[model samples]
Target: MEFRCIQDCSQCCIEREYYPSKKFGKIGVLILPEEKERIEQLAKINGLKISILPRIGISEEENSNPTKILAYQLMGIEPNGNTCPFLDTETSDKSPHGGFPCKIYNKRPLACMTYPLIESEPITLD
Candidate 1:
């Protein structure tokens, strides 16, 4: 299915309607060490808050293979879960085709760069 971005469809960035103009958005992306500095700095400039995923490498369940635990930074959550802080929640003239434009579109992470396109990809649930 060809996923087209519809106008006025803030479904992806309207998860937090209570506080429409939030600065610290919780993303579901797992950032890498190499991307930490860049993403953090940019996110800060855009008024977005970053959170560390798996904050710790050592957990109760994964005590055997500690390496499995990863420390990645994220901006938003599982697609519709959290509204991206970079997104212009205040839908107005700036919003295009009804969707909010990313404040850092050019520097968006790999997860967002390959959005919807991967939506159709097969999911392996082991």
Candidate 2:
């Protein structure tokens, strides 16, 4: 079997969901530690305001503040946490699939590149 994004569908980029639990609020596109600065720069160059939060971190001790961040998340623009800031919603231009194109598609995070393919009890596309 093969997987492909449905034409005219940008649900993956436009919709957000609470993960681990709602207490943590809606999760965003995962950005690796190495990609953090670059992602921030992309936002800045595009003149877009973005919110980034630590998604995973590591520390020497348990329950202690992380000394190093493993990954970060690029939050959405909506108050309810929908629509990635890099998604070109301002223009009528569309991706090859007919969905709204990502402003930073070429430089999108690895998570975005591997999206819909998640690891779980039984690995599957979301």
Candidate 3:
């Protein structure tokens, strides 16, 4: 079955407070080694700057700061949210899904290509 997103909704783009407890890490995703170079090149070609997130797996060490939890430096990360930088927000209202479309949908990073993947209990997406 095909899964489609709800209209006028971008809840998945938001961030979650990732703690060290349980299955957790930063709200941002990690970019695959294979996709990293491609995304970086594309960002440069398009004049877009992206943020880098470090890799931080679950820590058995005590007093670990979740705030500093790292991951494999993701590309296409939005500053204030988990949404990809290539997401076309302004054109959202005009789209059938009413969801902001990706500017580089065809060539988006592996992470952006897979979204709303439920881990644990399923929650409502705004």
Candidate 4:
């Protein structure tokens, strides 16, 4: 099977809410073992602030915290909907499709990398 994100469609990122972990709050994300060092190095070199989220911040009590974790939700969906802050719907005049762009494309979390793949450690049969 082929895995590829549809062109110009960040629907998944816009569909759910994401949150960073308390330990690495505002430091980007709780990257996987393989992604840790590279992301850190990038942040240091580029002077970029990184943060981590637990379970993509899909929680009811994300708010009411002292740290004031940045809250972002997709817009125009059912139940509770809001657009991700990172999703810039604005594009440049010279560009063809002007809209929200991912600020951290390179350092995006594993979730973004393995979107269509669901890896299971052990095979299960029911």
Candidate 5:
């Protein structure tokens, strides 16, 4: 199956929620291996005090709960079924001149980067 990633579509945010990152909890954003200082600097500039929690995922144990997983695919729910705070439906401004913006674009997780390319080769993988 060929999966063409979403074109500027943040649909994953539809079902992906975030939490206080285990390590970057105080920065309001999760920190990737190389994004620490950049994210920290950005947070400082924006005055955001949030942590970067690991993005949650559905597991085999939860396979029986299609509703739960479906929620993840449709609502970005937390393990406890809470909606993601970063999701803003009214902000899509994908203009040709550069207006569409994600509030957390820089701090977005690997999952966000790997969208639509789910089975790509490791080299192409996010």
Candidate 6:
């Protein structure tokens, strides 16, 4: 079987969930460390306000701040953390698949490119 996005459905881009727990709040689009700077630049170029937080990190010592961050999350725009900041909600333009267009579609992060397929036990869908 093949997997494809539903036409006129932007559910994946429009909704976020609290990962690990609610205390961490709704997790945003996963952005790899290498993509962080570019994402920030894109946001700046588009005149968008964004919040990026560390999603995964590693440290040389225990209980110490991460010396290197592995991943970051591009937070949503609403208070409940729904809707991607780059979803182009202001415009009426739709994506080729009939969903809201991504402002940075061609330059989207790797995580966004590989959605519904995550590296975990048994390689489950997210």
List residue ranges in candidate 6 displaced over 4 A.
Answer: 5-9, 95-98, 119-126
Superposed by TM-score, candidate 4 places the C-alpha of residue 87 at a distance from the truth, in angstroms, of: 5.6
Cα lDDT listed for each candidate = 0.56, 0.79, 0.56, 0.44, 0.43, 0.78
Writing each residue's lDDT as its tens digit, candidate 3 over 1-126 gives: 476655334444444435455354445555665666787787787777876555654555677755544346553354333565655565725456556755565676555445555565757988
- Looking at model 1, residue 103 earns an lDDT score of 68
State residue 45's C-alpha deviation in candidate 5, in Å. Answer: 3.3
Please give the RMSD to the true structure for each candidate, in Å: 7.3, 4.1, 7.5, 10.4, 11.9, 4.0
- What TM-score does each of the candidates earn? 0.55, 0.79, 0.57, 0.38, 0.37, 0.78
Name the candidate that leads on TM-score: 2
* Candidate 4: segments with Cα more than 4 A from true spot: 1-3, 17-30, 53-99, 104-107, 116-126
Minimal lDDT window, size 10, model 4: 71-80
Clashes of each: 8, 0, 6, 21, 12, 0
Poorest stretch of ten by lDDT in candidate 6: 1-10
- Top of the candidates by lDDT: 2
Give residue 44's lDDT in candidate 2 (0 to 100).
Answer: 94
lDDT of 2 by residue, 8-120 (tens): 35666775567767766678888888898999999999999999999888999998999999888889887666788988887787767678877777788887776677654
Point out where model 2 deviates above 4 Å. Answer: 5-9, 20-24, 95-98, 120-126
For candidate 2, list the clashing residue pairs, or say none. Answer: none
Residue 19 of model 5 has an lDDT of 35
**Candidate 1, superposed: residue stretches over 4 Å from native:** 1-27, 55-80, 119-126
Residue-wise lDDT of candidate 4 within 10-48, one digit each (tens)? 554454432243332222222554555665576566565
Better by lDDT, candidate 5 or 1: 1
